[model samples]
Structures are given as structure tokens and as C-alpha cells.
Target: MSQRLRLLSVLASSLLLSACVSSPKKPAPVEDRNPQPARTAAPASAPVPPAPTAPEPKPAPGAENAGKPGYYTVKPGDALIRIALDNGQSWRDVAKWNNLENPNRIEVGQVLRVVPPGVDAAAVAARPIASAPRAEARPLDAKPAAASASAASSAAVTAAKEPAVKDKDKDSAADDDTLAWGWPVANPVTAGFDEQRNKGLDFAGKPGDAVLAVADGRVVYAGSGLRGYGNLVIIKHNNTYLTAYAHNRAMLVEQDQVVRKGQRIAEMGSTESDTVKLHFEVRKLGKPVDPAKLLPAR
Candidate 1:
């Protein structure tokens, strides 16, 4: 029995050893290193800045005088007619604005009403009031003449002071002081001044025909601004007279140029007319007058 016990024990030990050997071995435990912090996303980018803005522009001085606010100070060369032409108004209209009895008179440094009087109260008030010329101081005691002759002479003078007599005298004066009459060209009159249609006289001529000034004058306007009167020249003979030569092929003089009577001022052409001709006009105080009355008889 004891032998049997020993053998059994040996067998049990053997089986135990075999089982332990057959079981799979487990890996050694890894060292517990600090766990990496969870990865965080980078911060978002900063916003971009806005662009800068530009500045506004200012207005210039001496701009167009469309709406006249202040008065126009008359400068050296400020004539009623010139002012009217520059301002696109008529001289008559300007005269009426100032209540001028005579349009011929204006003074330097004078403030003329460019805009209508109703436009601005300040401008109207700014106009310098003109005083009449001081009358010549007559002698308090004068030479006594014969009563009969003085009375008769006074009656005659009173009669001559009438409008009709004054007009006759003015006509005579104009005839006396006016330039010697001369024909501008030998061409016969093709058309005469017609108050209804023709503004002046037309003389048939060839291109490049010599055009003569009617009187001694200064060239006021030498341009093509007047429609239907292309390549024109305007001469101011005096304050009371002006002459125009239109449809000229070429102009020999310029503005403000002094010219003598019967001077060749232009070469005639049909700039705005149908045929080669010279268009001549005589203006007395801006009114169209018959050239035939002033020109030498043909």
C-alpha cells in the first residue's frame, strides 16, 4: 500500500508540472508613463482691417456767374454794349435796368447792376448814386442887349429848340462830321436793305474781292459768332456808328485794330451766302440804317 501511495504522489506531481509548462506566458506590465495631454486646435486667425477713405474736393474761384449774387464792379473797358455782349444781355436791357437816360455814359470803378435789380437787395444798394454835373455858374449880372433884338432872337431860338428842329440839326451835323462818302467796291447792288428780309446790302463780287471799311474806326468784333454772317468784321466808327462786313473770305485786321476810312479790311467771299458777294451794313446806335443814304451814289 505504501508503494502505491508514493507512485500516485509522483504521478500527481508530474501532471501538475506538465500543466504549468503548457499554459501561455503573459507579457510583463509596461511602466505607466505620463499620458500625453489631448492635442488642442490652434487659435483662429485675427480679422483683417478695413481700407482708408478719400477726402472731398472744393470749388474754384471765378466760376461761371450764372446767378449773380453780388454786384459787378465795372473795370477799365466796361462799356454798356460790351458788358451786355459778355453777359448775354442787350445794351438796351442794361440801360433800362439802371434807369439811364443816356446809355453812352458809364464810369470806371462804377458798380453796374449785372443781375436784375430784383435779384439782390444788397447789390442794388451797392450801386453808387450818380450826381448830375454841376451846371456852369453864370454871371449874376449880364450885359443888357437891345430889347427888341434880344426878344426876337429868343423867340427864334425857342422855335429851333423843338424836337423837329433838333432832329434836323442832328441830321445836318451827322452829314457834316461823317467820313467822306466812297464806294467800297464798284460792284452794283445785288440786294438792298429790306426791313422785312435783308438786314443789309449785298454786292455781287468774285472771291478774294477787296472789302473796304466805310469809315475810320476800331475793329470791335472779328469773328464768326454771328450766324448767317460768317467770317465777319465789325468796326466801331464812333459811339453813334458801326459798320459790318460779312461773308469775307479773309480778314486783314484784328479786334481793337485802328483802321482808316476806305481801308481794305477784308477779302470778300461767300462764307455764309449762296454766291460770292460782300454783305455790308451800317448801324447807327445799333439800329440798321440804309447804306445807300451814307455811301456815294453809284
Candidate 2:
């Protein structure tokens, strides 16, 4: 009984030592053969869209705006270059608008159309006139405040040097007695007067077209008495002027018939030439003057 007790005590001491020396550990959980995927940062936000823009409005037709196409009458002593420069146009544009073969050949009393910059006729006419700059000639003293006093004084001196304006009515009446001439017909001049050929100005027209008197005059002759002219009408305008319309289809006025300017005295016909044309002549004291020089510029 004593031997059995010694063995039991030894076993109990071994168990207590084992329990104190180490603890039982659980087995690790089964691991996945494939590794977990790495995480990625989110993409940057999309750029903001731009704002929408509005379209410009178009002008209406036939409105008179600041920049508009307009017409100007050519006065005496106006050349094409001068007209173009004055109207802010190019010589080429003037020539093209007038259908002029020669840019330098412009006559007085002709009307020229000027177009504004950067704008066409439709746009210009549609624009308002109040928006346009005033074209009147300004006084020299009304210059910018920043201008020097000497500059203003110079401008004043320049203004003082300009010639005084003359009354146009008085000038016209004074020039009236000088025997002004007019176009004999309402047609275009096809051929010009030539001194060497003795051919007078030729007007383009049909037979029986009325030929009018250039100025107030009394008919001196109305017959084909002169050679080379099939039918003729002659008028004595004044002491210095005697005008004739030859190659007429018929004479309307008799000898000594008083006719005013633009009065019809005969009809146009081709009596001398095959083509239908009026042979117009202007004589200064029995001498032939260039019909072109006597006729009013169109």
C-alpha cells in the first residue's frame, strides 16, 4: 500500500510541472493560396464644362444706320480721284459703279454711290443714323482740350486764310448771259465731234425721235438746202451762238419760229449715214465749236 502511494505522488508532480511549463495552442486557420488584390485610389473628377455663348443679331433691311451706302452729286471741278477721296471710297469702286471704261473720265453733275467700310448696302441702310458721326465742318476753336494753344492758334490762322463763300444764286445769274447750252436729245452720245473729220457729235436714237432746242432761240432755217444733210433745222441763239440739228426725219418748227430750251423742233434720223443717229452741231459766229464742250456734262 505504501509503494502504490509513492508512484501516485510522482505522477501528480509530473502533471503539475507540465501544466505550469506550457499551454496548448490551437491550429492556425487554413490560408488561401491566392493573395488579396491591392486597393487603388479613385480617378480624378471630370473637368467642368464651359458656359454657352449667345449669337449676335442681324440688321434689318433699308434702315439708315451710322454706316450706310449713300449717293453724292458731282459738282464742277470734281475729278474721280477727288470724288473718291472726298467720299471715302477707292477709285476702282467708283469706276466699277459707274461702268466707266476710264477711271479718270468723270463729268460734272454725275451721281456717285459710296459704300461704307466693313458694311454692305443692306447692313448700312438698316443701321440708325443717330449712331453715325456728324459730317458738318467743325469750328477751329472747338478742338480737344488737351491740344496746345499754339496748335489751336495755327488752326485759327488757317481758317482765317480761307476764301469767303460766294452766293451761288448771284453767280448763276451772272453766268446765265454767257449762252449756256444743253443736250439736243435725250439719248446717249455715241460719237464725239472731231475737228479734222468735221463730224459733229452723233447721238444714238431711232428715226422720228424728237430733237429739242439746246437753248431759247429763233429758227433761222428749216430746210435741206445744205448739202450732205438730208433734213436740217438751224436756230440762232444769240450774238455768239448758232446751233443746228441735222439729219432729221422731219422738221417740226418753221423758219423764225421762237423756241425755248428743250423745245422739240425736229425728229432724229440717219439722213447722211446709214445708221440712225442725229448729227448735232454748235456754231460760234459761223465757226464750228466742239459739240462736246457746249453740251452740259451728264
Candidate 3:
């Protein structure tokens, strides 16, 4: 029993010594001299939007004639009589054919039939007024405002300076006949063609002075129907050319009457003008050209 006690004491002593010698504390963490920074993702950039652009104006209604024969697209400032004259038809006939309750109440962009039924519109041998606004002229004799379209009308016409040719006008451009021209009056020109103001030549003359036909043509329009014209006359020389005599005291020739160049067509007077004068205009494809370009040199 004494020997067993000695061995047990020795084993206990060994365990006690082992317990007293604890494991060496871990070496202090070595200081890092160089450290790599942690990587981070960049926020996505916003996309830039494209710039907006302006939209083009839509075409007017009835801009297309709908391929209907004898149909005319009424433009701004179109007088029924003027439409009739342009198409070589009487205003009454046009009114009858269209069954217009009030001929003067036509609307802008309204399509009109200027030719009677059963008649070939192509054989009318006249150029329709350009689809653009009809060219306007200021009268020398009337007040500045008086030169505008008739007060009774709602829409007034203004000139289109340097207008581009329309498809309809272009179609007839190649077929228009070149013609001889003469002066409509023998008076000093008081005013000349101005695209912005005066659209034709103004001749200072006395009342009853003879207004001559500038070319041999049929009288397509001879009446006091147009505003600011005052007993005006429009002679259709050909499919492409026409001449206008405005502010006449008396129209000697009638509509549909054929007149020769240098023949007296009207007596010059202040009808819609301030002074006794003759306002002469030359239209090619319903576009006013400077009369000086067509008239003979004096």
C-alpha cells in the first residue's frame, strides 16, 4: 500500500507541473508595413438622352385635289369670279354647277368645281390660279387699308414673294406659250412692280384715257367683281399667260370678247385707285411677273 501511494503522488506532481507551464502567449500580431486597399464597385453613370427636334407643319386639307376632274382647290383670298375667270368659266356657271347657296362664302381648302359636267377640264385651255395665295396689289388711289380685299370677305389674300412652283403650276410650265406683248397704256409709270407692295405697274393718266390690250387674247374676265380692281379686266392670253387691267372707268370689251394687241379694252379711270391711273399686271402661271420683263421697251 505504501509503494502504490508513492507512484500515485509522483503522477499527481507531474500533472500539477504540466498545468503550471501554460502554452506561450501567441506573438503579438506583426504590424503590416504594406496593406492593399479593398476594391469597391463604381456607381453606373446615367445615360444622356438625345435632343428633341421640331415637327414639320401638316399639309392643309384639300391640298390634294383628290384626282377629281374640273376640281380646283380653293386657296386663300379666292373670289368666286376670280376662280371663274382663271378657269375660263362664268362665275354664274360655276355657282350653278357647284350649287353654291352663297358663292362668296367659300372656305379655305375647299375644293371647287369650276368646269361644267361633261366638258373636258383639260381642254379648257387655261391655267388655274396657283394653289398659293393669290398675288395682291395695292392701289395707288385708295387708302392703304382700302387696297385690301373687300370688307365683306373674311379671308384676305396676300402675295407670296418668290414662291416655289406647285406641282399643278409646274405641270403647265413646259406647255405655256410665249407671246408678244405691248404696253397697255402710254403714260409715265408712277409706280413699278414691288413684290411686297405694288404688284404691277401704275400709269398716271386722265380719266377716259384708253386702256389697250397688251396682247391678243380672249377676255376671260370683264366686270367690277374683284375688290380694289374697279371695273377690272383679265385677258387670258394663253394657258400660261394673262394680263390684268385694273381701276378702269369703263370696260369697252366684254367677257369672252377677243381683242387684238394695242386695241382699246377699257377707259382708264380711278375706280379703286386714288388718282386717275391704270394698274397693269402680267401673270405667268397665276404668279405675277414684273411687267417690265414682258412689255416692249419704249
Q: Which candidate should be chosen as best, given lDDT against the real structure? A: 3
Cα misplacement distance, residue 58 of candidate 3 (Å): 22
* Clash number for each model: 0, 5, 3
Scored by TM-score, the top model is 3
RMSD of 2: 21.6
Over 1-298, each residue of candidate 3 has an lDDT whose tens digit, in order, gives 9999999999999988887787655778999899989889998999999998889966543456644667887767777777765665556567778778776677777777766677776775346745434534222122222222332121111112212222211111223445777899888999999866776899998876778888877776676666677778887776567788999876666666666778777777787678889998887645667999778789
Comparing 1 and 3 on TM-score, the stronger one: 3
Candidate 1 C-alpha lDDT tens digits along 70-135: 345555544565454333333455666767666656655555554455655343332221221111
**Candidates' lDDT values, in order?**
0.60, 0.59, 0.68
TM-scores of the candidates are 0.44, 0.40, 0.54
Q: CA lDDT of 153 in candidate 2?
A: 52
**In model 3, how many backbone clashes occur?**
3
lDDT by residue (tens digit), candidate 2, 206-239: 8667688898766655655444555677776753
Model 3 poorest 10 in a row by lDDT? 154-163
